[model samples]
Structures are given as C-alpha cells and as structure tokens.
Target chain A: MPPISFALWLLVLVFDTGGQLAFKAASGVPGEGLGHWRAMAVRPWLWLGIAAFTCEFVTWLAFLSVVPLAEGVLLSCLNMAAVMLGGRWLFGERLTARRLLGVALITLGVVLVGAG
Target chain B: MNTRWRFYLVGFLLLMAIDTGAQLCFKLAATHAAPFAADPGWLLRVLREPWVYGAIAGYLGAFVTYMTLLKHAPVGPAFAASHLQVVSVMAASAWLFGERLAPLQLVGAALIVLGILVLARAEDEVAQTTPGHAR
Candidate 1:
C-alpha cells in the first residue's frame, strides 16, 4: 500500500471532530420515536452531522486506499485526543488530571504503535 | 438516551462491535480493489465487491445506533466508548487477517484502552454530577 498522506488524515481529524459536534448538537433537539427521528432528519445540525460524516467516509476511504488497516487505525486514534480538547475548548467541559493523563497515554500509545 | 447506566453500556458496546465489523469490511474491500491512483476503474470495481456493500450496511447500522446513543449519553463518554472499536478491530485483524501486533504495538494497544478508560470515567463523572444534568 502507498503511504497515507498527512493532509488526508488531517482532513479526517477535522471532519470526524466536526461530525461529533454536530451529532451532539442534534441530539439535544427533542425527538420521541423513529418517526420523530424523521423530523430530526431535516434538522440542520443532524444534516450537518450526516454531511460531515459523509466527508469523513470519503476521506477515510482515501486514507485506507493507501495505508494498512493497523496503521490507519492507529493514526485515527488521534481523533479521541482531539475531541477531548475540543470538548474542553468549545463545550466548557472540565479536563481533570486523570483525563489529561489519559490523553497523554493515548498519544504515547500512538507513537509506540506507529513506530512498531 | 438519558437512560440508565447499564442500558447505556450495552448500547455502546453494541455500537462498537458493529463499527469494528464495518471497518473490517472496508479493509477487505480495499485489499481486493486495485489502487485508485493506479487504476481509474478502481472505485467502480470496489463497488462491485460484496464487502463494500457490507461496509455500507454496517456503517448505516452503526450510525443509526450512534444517533440514538447520543441522546442517552454525553458526547465525551459516547465517543470514548465507541473508540473501543479500535481494540475490537485489532483483535479482529488478528483473527480474520492473520495480522499480529508487535510487542510495542501490543503495549500501545493497552495504553489506548487505558486512556479510554480513564477518559470514560472522567466523562461519566462530569455527566452525572454536573448541574442541569437532570440525572
């Protein structure tokens, strides 16, 4: 497989994070059942989430087209850390020492796996 | 969606499993198709693979389940739980593709799980204790 490009993975990072935010926002709107979910289908936030997810899919496929599954997934783990940061910054979520250590370990894990 | 912890755990684990299956199918399709840059017909050929369809189906199921999960839980914990897919995929790769993780990779995988666990607990604490959480 060809090497995955930095730009592609970066795009995935952005899209994935954006998708999560959209979904979170969309979930706040009231919906009762499968039918009410149809109502949400038209909501902008949900649409945005779906759109971002669609972009993520395209970018992810492009990345996988070049990189091995293990490597691609290892790199993708960066999203978890990124999302945590985003939550703190955008949502006013607290980041305690434990969470910080968790993020650090995740980054360290990526390095170890990537090196291997 | 704003449900009890036990139900949330079950839903989260189910989503993770489906997500792993979807990714595995994508990998299978990618392995089968010629490189897109090398062959203009690659996308069309890839679409012909049953695994590609399976990937789409699996992804749709995950997406739907995830939308539901979003309501019952906060994004932080939900994402943290969903990321269990990475570990699931690692094991699935070993079982299905005969791939083996290096010792370093194994250690790395452990850290990933540990990190997610720590993050999950923190998120859960935030959700349950924060004001306006409505229990």
Candidate 2:
C-alpha cells in the first residue's frame, strides 16, 4: 500500500469527524414551531455539516480508487476513535471506562470483520 | 445528557439500520455488476436492479438521520456506534449473500454487541439525570 493511501485515509477521518461534530451542533439547538424538516433545512450549521460530509464522500471515493475497499474500511474505523477524542476535547463528553472499553471492542471487532 | 439526547440515541439506532441496509444493497448490486469499476452506461445496467437504487437511497437516508441525531446525542458514543455499520454489513453479508464468515468474524460480531451494551449503559445514566424535556 502506498503511504499516500494512509495519508488520504487520515484526511478522510478529519472530514468525517468534522462533519459529525457540525451535524451535532446544528441539531443540538432547540427548534421553533416551523416544523422539523423545514427547521433543519434552514440551519446554516446543518448546511455546513452537509457540505463537510459531501467532501467526505468525495474523498472516500478517491481513497477507494486507490485502496482496496476492505483496507479502506479497516482504516476508516479510526474515525470512531478520532471522534471520541473530539467529543472529549470539544464537547466535554465523558469517557468513562465502560464507554472506552466498548469503543475498544468495536475497534477490534470491525478489524476482524474486515479481515474476512 | 438531556431527555433530548434519548431522541438522538434512538435516531442513531435508526441510522445504523439504514447504514446496514445500504451495505447489503451495495453488496447485492456488486455481485450482479460493479458499475463503478466499469465504463460508461454502467448506471443503466447497475440500476436495472432495485437494490442498486436502494443502496443509494439507503445511504442518503443514513446521512440525513445521522445529522439529525447529532443534534442531541452525546458526541462520543453516537459516533462510536456508527462504527457498528462495519460489523453489521459483515453480518448482513454472511446471512443474505450466503458469504462465509470465519469463526473469528462471529466472535467479532459478539464483541460489537458487548461494546454497544457498555455504551448504552453510560447513555442510560445521562438519560436518568435529565429532569424532563423542558429541563
């Protein structure tokens, strides 16, 4: 595998995590009585999140063109870890032992599946 | 950490379901034709099967729901759970496509559930503290 693939994979995580955070922040606000779908569409944060995720999909496609899907999926698991850290740093979300252990399990489990 | 976050977790679960459905349809479509890997007009051939279109629709559905979920769910756990997509797509492939999963993969699936249980417990604690929807 080319080192560039790994580098691109990390970039994929950055965009993905940013997308998630933006989406959450956008959604976290209380909505007016304007109705749910209409309300979400109107938020600038939601639009920003959408743009970030669109970037993620394009970068992901580029990554796939270079890397095998299986390998790409495996590497993409790191996005979970990145987001978890982001949660702590950005949102002050708790990282209790139970949650950390759970994350560890997911990471290992997904890698095993990718190995198939 | 609020009652609102419960709604977010529920939405996260829904997104996971959508994600799994997308993966399944994509796999079914791939076994039939890999339009992305092939030349032009591949869309017509690939789109012949409903699952091809289903795959795209499912992905879109997942994308929308995930953003909605981020609105209230605690960030770390919600993001962690989406990784369940990897485990789910694998399990779905084994069952639907008759693909063989190694014994280790089965173990992997079990581990995923265990992890989810741990995360769920933590979230439950948050849900309990929330006074009510208004609080």
Candidate 3:
C-alpha cells in the first residue's frame, strides 16, 4: 500500500504498454531479403520485443516472491483493461461501444476482486 | 501473514495487466506501421528505437513477479489461471479492434470469468478455514 510500491506498479504498466508496442512494430516488418525464419530472426526490433518479454517474465517472478499466487493472478487480470486502454490511446485502435461495455464489466469484476 | 506477500500479489496483478496491455498495443502498432520493405538494413533500423527500452523494462518486472509467484504458488494452477489473460486479450482485441469473435469465443470468455470467480471464492473459503493467517 505504500506510495513507492504503487508507483512501481504504474511503472510496470507503462513499460508493459511500451513493450507491446515495440513487439507490434517489430512483427509488422515484411520479409526482407532473408528467408522467412531468417528474416524474423534477424529483426532487431523483434529481438528487442523478445527481450522485453523476458523482462516481463522476470518481473513476474519477483512479484511472486512477495505475493500469494491466487491473489497475484487475480490482480494481474487487470492487465486486460490496461491493454485495451493502451491500445486505444497509443495505437488509435477502435473500441466499439459493445467492447467498451465488456471492458467495463471486466473492470467491475476487477474492483470486486480487489475489494474482496 | 506477512504483509510482503500482499504487496507481491498487488504487484503481480498490476504487472499482468500491463503485460496484457503491451500485447494489445503491439498488435495495434504493427497494424499501423509501414510494412518492411525488402531493404537490407530494415532489421538494423528497427532495433534502435527507444520503444525497445520500454519493452525491456516491462519484461524485467514480469520476470521478477513470475519468480516470486512460483516460489509460493502451485505451478499448475498458477499457469492455468494466468492463461485467462489470453482470453481477456482476445475478447478485448475483438471488441476494441474490430477483430472477429466467434460466438463460441464469447461463450468461452464468459466461462473463463465464471471459473475465475468460482476459483476466487474457493480460495477465500480455504484461506478462511486455515488457522493463524491474516491474508
């Protein structure tokens, strides 16, 4: 509940959003002169994306060191909402009214679990 | 109960949410960015962006959380439960990005939510039954 921990959590969120964007950018590159596997393997951004994912896994382990499993998993689900918001804001992705409603429901569910 | 575990749990949740967000963002960014032309140096060019730093930071947090969680939690349940994020991402992607979702997928999401709720309740019951704990 300390401010520092909360701030850390927020940092995690931002980093996560950025990582995804990087991966997306990397994955979008079309095949260059290299063969399919070779081209993919050679992408610099893709490696960065993979590295980002590796960091994510490491952080997850660190978090687990301090939290109960079930509780951790429940809280982590909040990422869905964060991702949706990030996609809309950063990528200008569309969120239809229906999907927004679904997100709202999920948010409500998160609040319920958090409060409980 | 150690308060540290609670902190860890909250941290894990937040990171997971962020992780999901990152994936979605990546998908969108890929969609908008220009396709890779068959240039020789395109790969090198993509590697040098600032965004890559962000990804690294995110992944570091995730890895730490995972290690901590694995120490105390059942791996099977932990992973099985975490996969729900995939469903969450899929649904959000379809709804927000206009990606198609089959009716079955919708049902699957609903089922996942239901299962999670049930599991959450069950966890609470078990916690309550156990003695000498404040969590």
Q: Number of the top candidate by DockQ?
A: 2
**List of clashing residue pairs for candidate 1:** B1-B72, B2-B72
Give the poorly placed runs of model 1, Cα more than 4 Å off.
A1-12, A57-78, B1-3, B31-41, B131-135
Model 2 docking tier (incorrect/acceptable/medium/high): medium
Error of 1 at B28 (Å): 3.2
Better of 2 and 3 by DockQ: 2
Candidate 1 CAPRI category? medium
Select the stronger candidate by DockQ from 1 and 3: 1
Score residue B14 of candidate 3 by CA lDDT: 65
Model 2 reaches what TM-score against the true structure?
0.83
How high is the TM-score of chain B in model 1? 0.79
How far off is model 2, as Cα RMSD? Answer: 3.4
Q: Which candidate achieves the best TM-score against the true structure?
A: 2
Better of 1 and 2 by TM-score: 2
For model 1, what is the alpha-carbon lDDT of residue A53?
A: 84
Q: Cα lDDT for residue B109, model 1?
A: 76
User: Of the pair 1 and 3, which is ahead by lDDT?
Assistant: 1
Q: What is the C-alpha RMSD of each candidate to the true structure, in Å?
A: 4.3, 3.4, 19.9
